[model samples]
Target: MAKLFTPYKLKNMELKNRVVMPPMCQYSVDTKDGMPNDWHQVHYISRAVGGTGLIIVEMTAVHPDGRITDQDTGIWDDRFIPAYRQMVDAVHSYGTKIGIQLGHAGRKAEDANPPVAPSAVRYDGEGYKEPRALTTAEVEEMIEAYAEGARRAVEAGFDTVEIHGAHGYLIHQFHSPLVNQREDEYGQDLPLFGERVVQAVRKVVPADMPVIMRVSAREYVDGGYDVDYITEVCRRYRDAGADIMHVSSGGEGPVGAGGMPVGPGYQVEMAAQLKRALDMPVIAVGILDEYEDAEQVLENDQADLVAIGRAMLRDPYWAVHAAKALQAEADVPVQYARGYRH
Candidate 1:
């Protein structure tokens, strides 16, 4: 049997396979109320039916101002629970475990009235404006918001919850020295924000529910943090109750600082390093879209799971097709079984 189709357990959660559908923002909430409409229902359910082992819903904002765009999903209100419940129910029917990535965009919130960040600096690029620094009080409020988001995620019946601490979002802003220039505790203790958020979310979820963290292991700019710094950050997250880490790099700033080498399985080594450094399970992302490559990562113990973003977006059946290609047994939906040749 291929490692890609092997069962992997994180605490009490058991995924049927190593394939993970990492959060990729759909930005489909047309009402601006942060509700998931029909588009989201079909978008996520199809992947569940297509044999994805775990479907992590996209970056869901904990506050309206936290949205990267007006269209991003939000869990800020109780009313949004039912919509998410419906999506969860549909995905569950196909026997797939589901998770949601809770986040606040901060300086990257292009649609915000005025974005907020850990510092008053503007993101260095067009399409991004200077953001007001989050006051210490507001920072505390955001922590509670994350806790509330986790509570709502539980109410909606998700099996796991991921805190988006990567990609230069609010948590990343606080974690990255280049973006965070405050003299307060947040600046002096850079990983404090992410650690607190993890602790907050962990408190709200079921004791057995796994809390995953997505982190940028390496920033692509000079003076930007690298794997060594992020490993220590991951240590903080683990101490704060994070069960797993999803490894991805570069979003803290513009990517022009001697671009990272891009290719298949480019980020696998980072995951391997974190796994060894922290003795924790991690999800290896970044171009490990091919089944063979994903299987190799698992077989080599580089990561516990593999996340395919662009490939999964292009084809919801990326997992099902991979099962066929790898000649591994996959629980293909009964209705679609006829399409799979013997």
Candidate 2:
């Protein structure tokens, strides 16, 4: 059996394979209520039936105004727990572990009358609104929001909780020197906000369930932080109780003099660096959709897990196909077994 198919355990979460369906926003909340409707459930459960080992649900806002758009999901209140629990129970029936990425869009909140960020910097995009700097009290409030979100995720019976600190969101804005220009403690210490978020999330979650922190390990903006600097930032997150780092790059925008790398496994080396630097498990993402490309990451020990975003979006049965291609043992759904034969 290929190493990718081998059972891998992180904390108390045991995955049947190394394949991870990273969080990708579906923007399906047409009702503007931030509830995970039937569409969201079917979207994820289909992948669960397709043989994915773990599925990280898309960015779920920790606050109402923290959404990128009205269509994104939010879990700011206790009312969302029952609905999330319903989806979680169904996904579990397929023998797959599921998690939710708790995030706040911050300056990227398109509908916000005035988006909030660590600083008053605009996202440098046309549709984005200029953001106001978060006051110290509001920053503290956001931290509590993250904790409450995790508490709700626990109630929903999610296997784990991932803090979406990547992609220039609220947490990312606080950590990025390019975006954060505050004079307060948060500005003085870039990783402070993210570290506090991890600590807060760690408090609400079970001791055995690992806290995953997804971060942009490398920024694409010309003056953005490099892999080494971001690695150190992630080191603080690890110390703050983040058990795993979901390594991804870019999202700060504008291709710099050094362009963003494209093609297969481009971010593998960065994930490998973080894994070595932090000495903890890391999930590598970035065009790693091919079966062999995903396998080699595990085979060569570049990362602990590989995330396939676009590929999984295109085919929910991706994991099943990869299992067949690699000739590895996978729990193909009994209903679909006949369809998977070579």
Candidate 3:
């Protein structure tokens, strides 16, 4: 059997396969209000139907002002519950577990509100503006926002809730020395923000619900947090209550160039590093499409779970295809069995 198709258990959650749909922002929510519309339902349901083990809903903003785009989904209000509930139900029908990635974009937040970060540093390049520094009280409120969002995620029937701590997002800004220059408790201190967010999330999320922390293992930029810094953060998050660490990299600044690298498992070394440092399961995601690559990641003990992003988007049935290519006899959904049998 392909390791990617093998069942794995994390805490109380058991995944049918290692194939996961990583969070990809759609920016498709209605302009009038941030709500999950039919586009989201169809977009996600198609993947679930394609037989992925875990499908993470996009990076939903924890607060109205935390969105990266005007059309990003929001969990701050109760109005979003029904839409999310329906989505969860739709995905569940395929026997696939679904997770929601909760985030606060912070300085990366776009739209009319501009953005806010640990410091007033502006993101490099166009469309970027100087972000207002978040005050101590505001930081406390942001922590509460994450907790509240976790509560709503549980109420909405998600199997897991992942905190978006990577990709130079809110929590990441606090971790990166390049953007965080404050002498205050939350600034010069690298792990304070992540530690606090993890603690707050633990308070609201149910004990049974798995909490995953998505982190960029390397900033890919000089003077940004490196593997050692990430290891410390992951250790702290695990201690605070993180069940898994989803490892991905880049996003230090425009110089880092998020998706410029084009190679298979380019960021797998980061996952390998974290897995060696922490006892908790580590998830590896980045340019992972081939079955051989996925198998090696597990066989070499680089990661416990393998997450696919653009590859899955291109072929929703990539998991089934991979199983066939690897000569693993996994069941395909009845609707697509004809193609597989042929």
Question: What is the C-alpha lDDT profile of model 1 across 1-342, one tens digit per residue?
Answer: 998998988988889998999999987888888899999999999999889999999999999999999999999989999999999999999989999999999999998868999999888868887899999999999999999999999999999999999998999989898988999999999999999999999998989999999999999977788899999999999999999999999887777657889999999999999999999999999997778898899989999999999999999999989988998987888888888856
In TM-score terms, candidate 3 sits at 0.96
Cα lDDT computed for each candidate against the true fold: 0.93, 0.92, 0.86
The runs of at least 3 residues in candidate 3 whose Cα sits more than 4 Å from the true structure, single-residue gaps closed, are 256-261
TM-score of each: 0.98, 0.99, 0.96
Model 3 C-alpha lDDT per residue in residues 1-342, reported as the tens digit of each score? 778888988767788888899999999987748798989999999888888899999999988878988899999987888899999999999888999999988878877365888999987757877899989889888988899988898899999999999998988988888888887899767778888889999888778788999998888665566789789888988998999999998765765543356599988888988888897788999988887898789888899989999999899887777888888766588877777665
Off by over 4 Å in 2: none
Can you list the residue pairs that collide in candidate 3?
A: none
Worst 10 residues of 1 by lDDT: 251-260
Give, for candidate 2, the lowest lDDT window spanning 10 residues.
333-342
lDDT score of model 1? Answer: 0.93
lDDT of 3: 0.86
What's model 2's overall lDDT? Answer: 0.92
